[model samples]
Target: MKTVICLVHGAGHQPLHYKYLIDALRRHGLTVAAPPLPTSGYDDASATKTHLEDVARVREYLVPFLEQGYEAILVGHSYGGRIITQAAAGLTGEERAAAGQDGGVVALVYIAAFTEKEQPLTPEILGVPPEDVNPATKLLWPEAAIRAMYHDIEPGRANEAVALLQRQSPRDLDGAAVCKSSDVPVPKRYVACRQDRVISFGTQLQFAEAAVAKVVAELESGHSPWLRDDGIRAIVDCVLEFSRRRQDDV
Candidate 1:
């Protein structure tokens, strides 16, 4: 069966934002499953659903693939890292196979994303200094963050990216995700965005270290690494490399 990449989107942004990456992966003969988080709706002033809700949303997409005997690769971008970590909790090949189940999550890929830690991951935690940050933290489109988040992308794509930016909840960032890094004992890799403003290079290293991540791939893009010309392919290539190791180990 083909490897299916289950994409967990970032906060505020919907799955559609992953269209470019998804299409590229598909063209390479890979399957992609990108879902919009429940918290991604616009004008959702009262969106109180936590990261667990987002986890459940991802599981909904993965379970179907597992049922059909296909390996699912959980790939999270930015805040999607929190959701994928929680969603993948207790769901691994060894555990599932031991329980007489099959086709579990094989690996994790974090693209400029968060990792398991005691405290909830916030912008401050990821190296965005709190000096001039917002209290509500509800960032509007085309904000200064874009300058840092997508600095490397072509200037023409700015408006398109701005249009996709939505209001992410501070509660979600401040609240701890449901799962721990140790909870999901699977081979993983961290695709660090070298020039990421949202999560600095040093901060990304910190998260990877905390998770004890097996591999790390550095990209020369901004916070949103997928915008780089070779961004999505590099990620898929890294996953394939991990997959090879997984097969060899077994």
Candidate 2:
């Protein structure tokens, strides 16, 4: 069976963000799954709790598929990357040990995603000082920033992307602060976007280093690499190649 590639979307964004990447992976004869995450008002404590709950829920749904003889690799973008880390932490060592065979999630891929040890993703990227930053904050994408970040995307596509932005609860940011995972011995990769405004490239690199990812690639594009064919291809190819190498070693 082909290893399953489970794509987790970032905070406030839906699975639709990964449509192009998913299609490309499928074209290469890889199995892909992108699941939508729950969205609620920013700064709502209850909503934030629900968001984390939803992350676990999605993992439960995928677990059975894995048990049914399918190997899977968890791929996460932005906030979704944080969620996958939490979900993977929830699994027992035995479960992860079992999945290690066949290159199924023998590694994790984070696309401009946050790691527990990285700088906080805040709305202050607009240039406000940290002291002025609020725990319950929301950042709206400015038109100019959007253009710079997603230059490869079509105008219409970029406009549509705006609709996917959600106001994340303050708790979501808080959750990431205390998140921790035992080193499950799975290889990890971090795809950094050098021009990202939402999450600083420096922060992403720092997170990758803290997480101890085996491989790290920096893209010249913005936060959303899916809009660029080359970026998407690089990610999919990396995951596939990593999976193959793991299987061979086993």
Model 2 residue 39 CA deviation (Å) reads 3.6
lDDT of 1 at 3: 69
Report the lDDT tens digits of candidate 2 across residue range 161-211: 766555555455444432453344466788998878667788778778777
TM-score of 2: 0.80
Candidate 1 stretches greater than 4 Å from native:
117-137, 173-176, 243-250
lDDT of each: 0.74, 0.66
Q: Global lDDT for candidate 1?
A: 0.74
Clashes found in each candidate (C-alpha, N, C closer than 3 A): 0, 1
lDDT for each residue of candidate 1 in 1-250, tens digit (9 for 90 to 100): 4467898887778777777788777776777888778766677652676676677788898888887866778988878887777888767767788888877888888888887635355546555555434455355335565665766777666557768767666556446657787788787789997788887888788778777775467877888767666787788687677555655765
Model 2 pairs in collision: 10-80
Per-residue lDDT for 66 in model 1? 82
Poorest 10 consecutive residues of model 2 by lDDT?
Answer: 126-135
Task: Write down the TM-score of every candidate.
Answer: 0.88, 0.80
Instruction: Look at candidate 2 and tell me the lDDT of residue 181.
Output: 34
